[model samples]
Target: MAGRRALKAVLIDLSGTLHIEDTAVPGAQDALNRLRQASVAVKFVTNTTKESKQNLLERLQHLNFNLHEKEIFTSLSAARSLLEQKQLRPLLLVEDSALEDFNGIDTLEPNSVVVGLAPDHFNYQTLNRAFRLILDGAPLIAIHKARYYKQKDGLALGPGPFVTGLEYATDCKATVVGKPEKSFFTQALTDVGCSPSEAVMIGDDARDDVGGAQNAGMLGILVKTGKYREGDENKINPPPHLTCDSFPDAVEHILQNLL
Candidate 1:
């Protein structure tokens, strides 16, 4: 900590660190408020492809989080940017709710396959169609290959396995555009005008959030809530700067120590 840059921003993970499903982590809202009051820039980052940004915003608001749409960034946003950059018509295998994020993209004659966490769209017919397209030279775009996420019921499958299946069968590697990707962290940090060394990432996923940010040159805090399992801090090389029990604890560390 001797030579670290002064903290100027915080990139927070959405689902596990702040909330799980419809329930906000205990005192998370207040914790966020405290951070805001400190005058540091704050941004929300997530790989949730289950719903559109608008829908996700509504859910967060319903849970009493005070945030704006522009302050939130999702993996869907990154995938859309990639789609536009490549100018490829994608066969989006994402949830109907998430399709709203890709509304303007051409999907009629798909030249690419974009996969997310869409249980309803993971059927044999849909996958077969995507498989055929990939076989025909369509690029496979994976929004994020997360293994599992925490829900009210417990851990559930994420889109990683499905994306890997497509990759294995098609013999084509997927272009991932989400967490743990340096580009994703850079995009979020750029928007807030903060350098990675001057920011911190607080999240529950050890690999995607903490390790990812650390890889991008920021400090990371691993919280025990959300999808965190036992000994997750040890799963990654160069463990988190700190591990807290919840969002509030992370915030406390930031406010007391980092500031």
Candidate 2:
């Protein structure tokens, strides 16, 4: 394929693209260093909702990955932006500390509701109350839409299934403020002041990063890392523009075909 010489930015997925389970992928760090040396701007886009933006950055730094807070985009950030844009004040169903510095619209009304990963807090009473709020027409917002996430032990139920239950009980569709949604992608591009054509989305999840970016008019590159297995290509609805063995190879392809 001809190089997209106009490309100016690269959006990478954190888990599969850079590392897996707190361990940096081989050649991932070097690839990022190369991009920085070349002055090619980069952004880390993720669907993880369990950690705050600062926390995520700190973790990455601890892993020896050079990144700044501003270079990261989380689904939580997108959720906050959507709430602000819709002018919806919600009754938060999230972690108390998560909203400490949240500057978005107030989410404290009786009719407002927001759900977070509260495994320890989830119970019959709380869920019942949340359902009532939803029945009352409060807008539902979720940070992630994943059915489950990979863990050292095994797969764990993600926020998606819980969000789905709420949607079914109240018949209200939850507005997902994460990947595969155009709003989040648009927000990231706007934040960097870059066009979709100038950016490439690289990730292991075919549905979220690759398909999402392609849907928004950007190039998508799939990496064979986290959550992706051999022969998973048949499952991709909209095939990626390029597929690489790992993040390092993906970066090399970008340098050759895009830069």
Candidate 3:
């Protein structure tokens, strides 16, 4: 406590940290306002693939979040960047809402299978097509592998199970481009001009958000909001530096300890 460095920036998770489904967490808007007032650099990072970047931004705005398009980073965005960098034609297995992110990109004779959380796109025929392609030596690129997420009704399955299934059947390791992967957090930190040690990550998922950030050399604060189970934080090996019930609470910790 006596030797902690002053935190310079924050990476905030979306779906579970700020909102649950289409609704904003109570007081989350104010919490973000406070963070901005403190002059801490913030970047909203998410693993959701159910919508395009525009759709995600619009949704956040609808929920009264103070954010800009440049501040929002999603797994879909990372996937697109990877695809373009490698010049690989992707057989995108993502939700219809997310397809726009890859629009106008050459997908002919797809050699890469990019998987996101799209329940509607997981039918036997569709999955079979993806399976066949993978079997034929196409690389499997998982935008995210989140096991489950909290929904309005209850917890629901995420894309991790599906990604694991494909991995098992194909015997090929997937190229993960989302949370729980150090590269994602590092990339965000780099984009915001902050060193990993100078920032903190706040989110609900113990494995992805908390564990991922910690692994990437940043402090992690686990919030007990969406998708957070009672003992979720305890499940991770290197525990989060702090745990709070909501973003507002997490912000309070940051203000006191870091600023």
Candidate 4:
């Protein structure tokens, strides 16, 4: 890598890289422990909007991963920050479980539309409601436009298609506040007090996790797990700094070379 700097922090993708659903990736827990022993600042950055941060932490703990809630930065947090910054009450089309993160936000007479992966809310009536709202000048905010994500049973559709449908209907581009977005990476890096050059991002999605981090000036490592398919690395221009077999493999690389 041309701009290699001393590794100060490691930003990891939670769902796919470390675990998929309730099942932990092989050796991932031990691998994280290795990183912990090495004294590297580790932060979990996720675009998961299915559940609140508290719930997510609980799931991680259930999977035997030890981490603090504050160490986890999420796109939901970013979307909420944006909503607060603009003072726009939003009609949230996210999962009910994810609503806890936006608890304090005003949702009355929503002046904007915030969307994530909400299968229950993606029905015709609800989508039409959001459609009418956007057609009436309400801004659309997408937490992330991932095409699909890994589930215990193969892959499932993400909110990208829904977001695109809204965009097409309203002819208004939605403001994205998740992975592959430079602002999200900037915010995550800021929390760890690390510059982009001093951080590495490990994830399974080549486009969002790897490509996005690389675009934001961090070394991106694509893991061959989660929603990863063969030849995914080639899909991105300037492929990942390293494409490893799994989370543990990525950690070994960090300990052996990057450190």
Candidate 5:
């Protein structure tokens, strides 16, 4: 706390911090409004690979969040940027619904293996192709390495295990482009025109949102919502700057204390 800088912008995790699945976190709208009233820059950062950015925006709008596409940064967005820059054609192992984000990309030759949480596409044939591609020198690009995520039913496996399995089989490590990865956080912070020390990251996932932000020199606030499990905060290497009950409470904390 002694070395912490003043909070100027906030990078919020979407799935757990603001909502889980399709439902908005209780009081999330009000908390967001408070941030707007506080006049701090805000960005919504997410590792959710289940839907394309446009679909995600629609879902958020349905949940009553007033966010612009520019303010929303996804791991997929980061992956897309990298892919386009490298001019790598992806052998996509992503959800069909999420394919729209990579819509314009050329995938005819399948130069790289872009893996996300595509449950339906995790069969032997599809994975075998990705595995062979990686073994044949194509890079494995993971959107994120989340072990698991919260769903409406309960906790469910995420893409981390699958990504690692492929890594072990192919003896190739994945280039992660999502949370817990500094690029994702830094890029979002930079887009908001704030240095890492001047911004804060708020989310439910201790490892990804909180730990990742902390590692990147931003203050991290762990919210007890979404995929949060008890003792998660204690497990992080450098613990979150604060832990709160919900997004609104985190908003209150930032306004009253950090600002």
Candidate 6:
């Protein structure tokens, strides 16, 4: 394949791409500052569904990340949009604060359902109830399809399996609202007023970021900082347009090549 072309906008992962364990990676902030100075459009895309949009913005601000809420896109936001478009309220199988910003009605009606990450609230009983609701014709929606997320300690089960189990028991398909889905990428591009070909996605996860971008008709760049390991490049079904050591390096490459 040809090398990834220049981009009018850059979509970046938040956690490992910008900061690790609350610490901003070396040159990460500088790179973002440079992008701003050069007037390069940028968006932060994250799969984290544990926090509300306001809370996420506040947290990132507390971490000294100079970003606006509009430039951030989360799986939770996607899921919320999906439910609202359907005019269906969900039982909300998520954290108490997850539905705080959502506009949908909350009810136990047969048309209502659940969506979100499952950690503390995930138990056999919760799964059973979710299953029952799905069997009753309630739709299941997943924020992101990630099976696990990297933690400081180790890998832990994420929202994917819980959603999968419910799908299995209820025999209902779930609408995934996160990356690798065209809706999420298209929405982000639309927010910036850029075409799919005018944007580039950079992240540590090849499948979620790189592969997703490629599938969305955007350029994809992979960074070997977070979950990506050595020898994983060969495994990418469609190789990324470019690969770098970290977010800073990736930003530098964008500056050098695109600007």
- Across residues 132-157, which tens digit of lDDT does each residue of candidate 5 receive? 99999999999999999988989888
TM-score for each predicted model, relative to the true structure: 0.98, 0.90, 0.97, 0.98, 0.97, 0.92
The TM-score that candidate 3 achieves is 0.97
Candidates sorted by lDDT, best first: 4, 1, 5, 3, 2, 6
Off by over 4 Å in 3: 1-4
Error of 6 at 209 (Å): 1.2
Cα lDDT tens digits, model 4, 98-150, are 99999999999999999999999999999999999999999999999999997
- How does each model score on lDDT? 0.93, 0.79, 0.90, 0.95, 0.91, 0.78
* Residue pairs of candidate 2 with colliding backbone atoms: 90-107, 91-112
- Using lDDT as the measure, name the better of candidate 2 and candidate 4: 4
Q: Model 1, residue 127: displacement in angstroms?
A: 1.1
Which pairs clash inside model 4? Answer: none
Task: Mark the 10 consecutive residues where model 6 has the least summed lDDT.
Answer: 101-110
In model 3, pairs of residues that clash are none
Residue-wise lDDT of candidate 6 within 1-259, one digit each (tens)? 2454556798988876777666776778777887777766889888877777787778778877789998888888787777778878677777766666575455646476656775767888877777887888878888877767667787778788888888888877898888778888988878688788888898887888888888899878888876777875666777888988998788888788775
Candidate 1 regions with alpha-carbon error over 4 angstroms: none
- Per-residue lDDT, model 4, residue 259, is 88
Estimate the overall C-alpha local distance difference test score of candidate 1: 0.93
TM-score of 4: 0.98
Residue 172, model 5, lDDT: 85
- Candidate 2, residue 197: CA error in Å? 1.8
lDDT of 4: 0.95
Q: For residues 1-259, write the lDDT of model 3, one tens digit per residue.
A: 4565678889999998999888898999999999999878999889989998899999999998888999988888889999999999998889899999999789999999999998988788888899999999999999989998787888888999889999998898999999989999988877778788888999999999999999998899999999998999899988889988999999998988788
Candidate with best lDDT: 4
Looking at model 6, residue 165 earns an lDDT score of: 81
Off by over 4 Å in 6: 1-6, 108-110
